[model samples]
Structures are given as C-alpha cells and as structure tokens.
Target: MELSLDAKDTAFRDEVREFFSTGVPDSWRDRVRAGLRLSPDELTGYQQRLAARGWGAPTWPVEYGGTGWTPTQLCVFWSEAARADAPHQFHQGLELIGPIIFSYGSPEQKDYYLPRIIQAQDWWCQGYSEPGAGSDLASLRARADRDGDDYVLNGQKTWTSYAHVASQVFLLARTSHEARRQQGISLILAPMDTPGFRINPIATMDEKYHTNELFMDNARVPVANRVGDEGRGWEYGKVLLDRERMVAAANVIFLGQIVRGITDAARRRKIRGRALADDPGFAAKLAQFTVELTTLQAMVLRLLDDMTRGADSGPRGSMVKLRWSQLYQAGTALWVEALGPEAAQFAALDGATLPADMPAALQGALYARVTSIYGGSSEIQHNIIARRALGL
Candidate 1:
C-alpha cells in the first residue's frame, strides 16, 4: 500500500515534531535514548506535560481529553515521539483502561477515573495475567466472590508491569464459575493500597524492575468498581488487547531508532583504520535491515489506514505483532553486535543512567528477547493469523 500524507497531515506532523523536539525535557529524552528506565514520577510528569498541551490521550475522543486525531495523525505523533525519544504516555492508564472506562464504565467511573488518567494523577497497572493464564487468558482462575457490598478477590497476577509503583490496578476476575470460561469474567478496579494486596518484584534478565507478582487475597473492592456488566469483562479485555496489538507500531518505530543508532555507532567505529560502516558484510546486513524495516513500516501504516477507514482488517493486528516482534529481536541483536563484545557487560541494576549507547544496546537486546513473549506470544499471533487472516 502507498502511504502519503496530505498537506494538512503534513502540517500536523510538523507541529507535533516541533513540540516533541522542545516540549519534553532533554534529560528525560536522553535517558529514553539510552534505554534507561524513567522513574514513576518522571513518567507521570511527562504525561502531565502532554496533558497541558492537550495531547495526553491521542486515541481517546475529544470529549474525554483526547486529541481526536485521525489514525494517521496518531501515527505521526508516535513516530515523532519515538524519534525524539520521548517517554511514552502511561499506557496502562491512558491506552489500556482509560478508553474502556469511558466506553463501558458508569458515569461515576468516568467522572472519577478519566480525568485522573489524562492528568496522570494515578499510576495504573494491568492485572490480567496469572501464573497459570497468560496468552491463553481465558483460562485465568482469579476469582472475585460477592459479599454484601463488595467482591472479595482472591488470586495472584504475574507479569504485571509497574504494579509496585502503581496506585491502581484494573483486574480481571472470574465472577461466576458455572458459566463457560471467558463468559463470567468481570473487570474490577482496586486501589493498590486496598486490604490484602501484596506486590513482589520479579528480577528480569534485562535487569529491569518493571514486572511484578501481585497477590490479592480477600481484597475488597466495591461492587460498583466492576466495569460494565458482570459477565462481559472478556469482551472489554479483547478491546484492550486489540489496541495493545496495534501498539506494535510504536515498537516498530523504536526498532527503527535502534537501527539508526547502530548505524551511527558503526560509522564512528573503525576496523583496521576503516570505518565499520565501510565493511561490505556489515553494510549488506544494514541494507537488509533497511528493507525489512521499510516493509514492516508499510504493513503497519496499511493496517492503521485500514483501521481508519473502518475496515474489518481481520488478524492484521496479529500479523503486525508477529512481524514486529521478530524484527525487534533482530534489530536489537544487530545493535548489540554492532556495539561489539563489551555490550554484553552487566550494568548496575539501580535504574542508573546508562553512560552510553553500548550499555543501552546490550540491555535492549536482553529485553528484546521477550518481545515475542509478551502482549501475546509470536506463536499465538501465528495461530491467529493462520486462522483469521489466511483462512487456515
């Protein structure tokens, strides 16, 4: 598919580019460029800055503080943000649960949560995954049994990113057991400080403190905290998952950034008095990666365009997720390779500033190893594409 931006779109892109260039603090962008994790306060502050400019929630309706930009404009914003190494807008609240609350939540829910989400007043994490149920999420066994005015939740959620830092969590609990799995699931909201909630940090190979194990035992959330009907949480989760799949576009943009960084580093390094970029072997690999990045980018733009035009676009999200995962791993691998053997050295795990691109590339590659696993595994995406996109 041919992708072209009209004049108006071009102007919007320029505006977005200019803002991201100057609006975000350079210190924050530097950390992001170096693949260093930003503190929770820094993240919230970045989103608040976006909020001041009315750009906090790009995909939400204008009524709910969204920019209401078209899909293309949203894509442009994301591209520019990645290029500038802008810290991402808080995704769990802004992208994942915010839209769901506005669309399916009660009026009180909207009043209480939507503004805080856009304002970044609260940190949020997802509570959908469990030790037993991950990609096959319907098998999740977390249960929330009803009491007089609240549901006593009992279960554990693993792989929950930012739970340790979050103030709130949107949880999926099996509210009914007699019905088929995936039919009786309910989406519930609970404060992290609620009774009987515990968080355990999981040390990842990437040396990041992002994921956590959450234990909830008799956690009392008001019945009113349930989003929408009791039995349709699975449907709401699917909506979030579709949006999550499309998020591969942003990762694709980051992969491009990694490749560019590697290319720049290669041009600066010399082998036998010749720049590494001058090596035909390395150049050939770079050329291949360029072609692959271009193909994947075009695929993402086409999917966004399809979505914009309100087309069915069956399984294209899965296709993008699958392709982007593979390409991300490959790109990060190239980054580490370009950086040489020293890139593998372990850096401090204290979220300290990575001094240079070498450590960044190494940590990124380590993290990239899980690109295919999270947000639905490549295996699952392949199955989805086979069944829905290819009619297998």
Candidate 2:
C-alpha cells in the first residue's frame, strides 16, 4: 500500500528533516549510527540545543517547553531523529517523570523540576525495580516512614539504569502496609547525593556499566518531595509506564536504520569474489526483515492515529514492544553474522573513540540481547495481548 501523509504532516516531516541535517553535528550522528555510546556531556549538550529550539521535549505540552505538535508530527520527529542518529534525549526525565511531576506534583514541585528536566540540567533515574520486584512492580519492598517533615527511606533497588550518572531519582516506596500489594506505595523524589544513598555498578556481559544497584539507607527526603498523595503512587506509576510504552513505539525507525546499514554492509562485503548482497539466501532474509519492518511501521502509525482520536488500542503498545524487541534482536544478529568473523572485534566501555563498523556492530548485537528482557519483557507483553487484545 502507498502510505502517504497529509499536506500538513508532509511539510512538518520536511521541516524536521532539514533541522536534523543542519542543526545536529555529523560526528554525533556517525557515532550513534555506529552504535557507540555518547558521553553524558555530549548527550546533555545536544539536548540543550534542542531545548533552545523549543523541540527538546517533543511530546510534552507546549506550555511546558514542547513543540505542541500533533501525534503525527511527533512520530515524524522521532523517526527522523533516529534515522539521523541523534542522541535520544534522556527519557527517564523527559518522558517519564516530567509529565508525572507536572500532572501530579505540587506547584512548587513543578516549578523546581520541569525546566531543569527540559534543559537536561538534572539527570534522573527510576527507582522502581527491587531484588524481588521487577515485572511485578507492585511487589517492591522499599520502605518510607514519615518522620515529621521528612521521610526516611531504606531499600535496595536493582537494575537501576544510569544511577551512577543521575543527579536525582524518582523512587517508589511503600509508606504503609496495606492488604493489597499495590496500595500504600508513594513516589518520592530524592537527590542522588543524599548522605545515605549509594550506587554500585553491575557488570554485564557486554562489559558496560549500563545498570546499577542502589542502596537507600535512611535517605531522608522532605515530605514535600512526595508526588501526588501518599498511597497513590501506584496510580502515577501506571501513567508513566503507559507513556513509556507509547513513546517508544517509534523505535521501529531505528530498526529500519539498522536494516539499511546491514544492506549497505552486505553490498560492500564479498564472499568468494561475489558480493554477499547478491546471494539469494542472504537477500531473502533481508527481504523478509524489510517486509516485517514495514508492517511494524504501519502498526505504529495506526497506534498514533488511534491515540490522536482518543480511541483505545488495547495492548497495542505491548504488541509493538513485543514485535520491535524480537525484530531488533534478529536484525542485530543478522548484521553481525553478515559481517563474518570480523564482527567479533568488540568495543568495551573504556574505548575512547568509536570502533570500526564490524566491531561496533558486534557490540550492538551483544547488547541487543537485553531488548526483549527489559521494558516489561516479552512474556509480559504476550500475556497482556493474550488477555486484553485476544480475549484468550
């Protein structure tokens, strides 16, 4: 089918394309396309540039430093950004907590946090998952006891991404022991430098410090830092989770970029004096991925359209997350395999410069194993679709 945009969205797409071409630096794009990690300074600096242009938080309300674009425009922005290899803005702050603070926070809380988040001034991390609670987040055991104007927090949070670099954390702590596991949970904001807070990096097979374990030993936060009412954090967390899934729908565009890179590599590499791209077997696999990616893109558009019209696309985000994760893993595997044994030259976290394409592709495939595991896991998404969408 010919998937076409309306005149307005088409113009917006061209505008976004122009900005990415001119506004973003070529070095950043090259590094991102190679799957090399950008430093914190590089990330924040780029975000600041986007903020100055009033496009820092694309999906946010206009009153809150967003572009006020339609869902279609927002989709276009993310798609182009991915294709251009722009550094993704820190979503823990912009996509997750910024909305929560604005929608459920006190006036003082909004004034303090919103601008900082938009400008990338204060990096934030989520403190939701614990040793025993991840997919079933309501089972988190972090405790927060009221002590006058302060709440003393004590718990351990595992799989906390970017805690080592974050200046703040939004924690979900149990304030009371209610009969229902989901009840009595409260969202609390605390500075990472709090006297009793500690962060230790967890080593991964990729040789990267991408996640951490957090220890909160009597980390005292002002009661004013509480988001919404005490015991209503479960409700706020649900909102953030929903937004996270929906906002990530455009990630299929990145997969498209990966596939394009694979095709380019296939054309360049030769096997027995013939280009790998000419091999029927390899070409067929690439063609299948292209078709699957096109279908996923259509699903994303339909989800955006339904959201714009206030229609409930039940478990649609789950479906996208599930399919996208599977495709990402498969695409990365294909990319590395197509590169031959040269793909085994992997880059570590200590590398100062971007690795060669083959090495970077390998590193990316190693990391791709986590795609299906995080963001509520493939199993959870299947269960969601089975019960909600399929009525099975």
Alpha carbon deviation, residue 362, candidate 1 (Å): 0.7
Q: Per-residue lDDT for 202 in model 2?
A: 94
List the pairs of residues colliding in candidate 2: none
Clash tally, candidates in order = 0, 0
lDDT by residue (213-267, candidate 1, tens digit) is 9999888999999999997898987676557645666656555666666786688
Query: Could you estimate the TM-score for every candidate?
Result: 0.93, 0.94
Worst lDDT 10-window in candidate 2: 347-356
Candidate 1 clashing pairs, residues 3+ apart or interchain: none
